[model samples]
Target: MGFLIGQTYRKMVGILAARFKEYDITTEQFSVLCRLAEQDGISQKEIAARTVKDQPTTARILDCLIRKGLVHKEMSAADRRSFLVYLTPLGRERLDVLLPLEKATLAEIFAGLDAEELARFRETHLQLHRQLDALHQQQEA
Candidate 1:
């Protein structure tokens, strides 16, 4: 089951990467962009947490996005050491274009599953996530 899940994750990333190729963005970058779109001017730490990426990995992704002129960072007034991240206009425009592509890709991928099945699948995943979170907390404790 873990193997199948890993395989499915890789395949989904590949599909999304192919779709995002024209925009010169990776699946990881798109994920970060989506988060920024939802809440702009957020600290990198917040973005990292929301995206489930480590600070170093998130910094690297932000570097790529910054290079592409899709994202910019400003030093936070509250914490000069940390920076607040925001999407450039270009980034927002790109996201607008990519959002539909993402939705369409998901729709295509889940086409076989009816509404009820999809709901069940989502619930199952949520339950798994909760279980994992509990395990993680236990480990921390």
Candidate 2:
């Protein structure tokens, strides 16, 4: 089951990465952009948590985006220690172009699946993650 899940993930990411090449972004970077598009002006720590990545990894990604002029960070007014991340106008424009491509690429990945099956799949995955999280907490305790 783990192998199947991992393989499916690899396949999906591979497809998305190929589709995103022209936009000069990886699937991981694109995912970060998507998260920010949903809600911007978040701290690096928040982005790391939301993206399920380590702080260093998230910082690296954000740094690359900043170099590309896609995203920028400012000292948070509420928190003097951390910076809030935001999408630049270029980032929004890039998203406008890539969003449709992302949708189309994902549609290809789920080609034959109906809405009901997709919903069930989503729920099952969520349940699995919850169970795993509980197990991890138990081990830590």
The best candidate by lDDT is 1
List, residue by residue over 38-95, the lDDT tens digit for candidate 2.
9999998989988989999998999999999999999999889989999999999999
Candidate 1 residue pairs that clash: none
Best by TM-score: 1
Query: Every model's Cα RMSD, please?
Result: 0.7, 1.2
lDDT of candidate 1 vs native? 0.96
Off by over 4 Å in 2: none
| Reference-based TM-score of each model | 0.97, 0.94
Worst 10-residue lDDT window, candidate 1: 74-83
Clash count list over all predictions: 0, 0
lDDT tens digits, residue span 28-58, model 1: 9999999999999999889999999999999
Report lDDT (CA) for all predictions: 0.96, 0.92
